[model samples]
Target: MALASLAAASLPTAAAAVRSRVSLLRRAMAASPSSSSCAGLAGSPARVGVVQMTSVGDLDANYATCSRLTKEAASAGVKFLCFPEVFSFIGSKDGESIKIAEPLDGPIMQRYRSLAKESSMWLSLGGFQEKGPDDSHQYNTHVLIDDSGEIRSSYRKIHLFDVDVPGNMVYKESRFTTAGDTVVAVDSPFGRLGLTVCYDLRFPELYQCLRFKHQAQVLLVPSAFTKVTGEAHWEILLCARAIETQCYVIAAAQAGKHNEKRESYGDSIIIDPWGTVIARLPDRLSTGFAVADIDLSKVEAVRTKMPISEHRKFDSDWKTS
Candidate 1:
């Protein structure tokens, strides 16, 4: 489908009627805490908080920032929270990163687990450099921690960001990280969540499997996107994924200058099923968060109205199950 056509399809419908109904629903939800999640749908919407950060080599400082952000999100009544890729730490060099890589059961993760229990909230720990089995190549691993602080799912990033730009910057992630081979999804309060990391944003086939095969309702793209590419393609790609898959897309990002050599484009966003940008944040050094109400009804509504999944034609040769 043409991008313009999808944009036009999502324009306001019966504007006055929708405004009035939304106002009433908000009022009702504010009055009852227990019923807030399901105010406008059969199943309760998962209220999500996306945390944006600029993490460097200081593990303790990153933890403090995350601690403050997590506490604030918890107070705001969010059930689940997601942090940017490499939320744990982003070192100045690949050698430094390899030196600091930790196991899933390391002290850093233990601290995160404790924090999750303290806040009584579920957390997507985003991406961290995990020590590979052989201890030579690292894995860009993402972990999903439940409300009770149990590790529910872990996905190693499949796409290594190997890019080059003349007179700009060149990054060959495969030199330091081993690519993963699995398509992972986990069941959560929000819905079934399809997991992918920074460079995975460029590949649409992986997302298709998450939607069609795994029946994922939400997709998480935690990233440390370069400023150049992010400016050009970030929102466009994020919205396209949401529109094509008919799923909620939450992208927490590393924003601002992390070190002397690198900076990230940080327009962190949460997009809905119909490609509507619900919440967003500008690039900044300070830690910040934006919350979005995740209603599966909206996903179903778009799918029912468009029926694109049923209309797909080139399915026989498609891979990535």
Candidate 2:
């Protein structure tokens, strides 16, 4: 089947790329709005919260942490909540993720839907391993649930993390997962949101398309950054994306040590267009959350001042070899 046909037929169930399920949910909601239960949350300034999880191989433990943190964020008047990558379970080894992969209509997604509805908040799951038919592949997916508990928008991690970082940090996402070909963004009360996952951060062009083409005012980057790179590049890169694009960036990260001898740098943050960190979690346990208010006016103000979008000069000599 063609890639579009395959994607249309079923939710992208490729485990390595995060946010595929959310992308699927977005398409579904767009196709049939009545099927979704969540209502749109509207306002110029959006109160956003993020959940950071130091997920282990245990599903129960991860779910409990998400539930608790979500409740806390809701109590704090957070209307939009985002979670870290692999919020359900981060396995100890490769292939171990397949064991925990569930279908889109399974218990895991259902739980998230219920949570969004009960809290009366728009929710975004960073990424999950969703089981596909025949169980051959699992999608690394993100999902957005509206305040009314209806699924809103979703995106698969288009840029697979298939590179070899020095010091033995090697990831071959294409080995077990499929790549997403399309970029996705969604409209909400907060503004247009560009959805992406961990590895996608390295590609600035994707953000350019999202910002310039889709008019995305906010970008959501849910990550499980490794210690080696996160310490050096995580914050800086995130800030740069926000500054360059003049958009709000919300990055909910996985922190602390996991059972597989892997340590994640946990510094989940919300950055404004001016590249200011509004909220962050102090280093501690592997699980927690942060909340911040996003003002769309700031995005407009920055864009108006810089006007980078309007001033574009392309040299004929510019070429890619």
Expressed as tens digits, the lDDT of each residue in 32-144 for candidate 1 is 22311212246777788887888889999999988888888888888888988999888887677788788899888888888899999989987888887666688999999
lDDT of each: 0.79, 0.74
- Residues 40-142 of candidate 2: C-alpha lDDT, one tens digit per residue: 2234567887667788898888888787877887777778888888888888887888777887778988888988888888888877887744455677787
Screening candidate 1 with a backbone cut-off below 3 angstroms (N, C-alpha, C), the clashing residue pairs are none
lDDT of 1: 0.79
TM-score, prediction 1: 0.84
TM-score of each: 0.84, 0.83
Ten-residue region with minimum lDDT total, candidate 1: 1-10
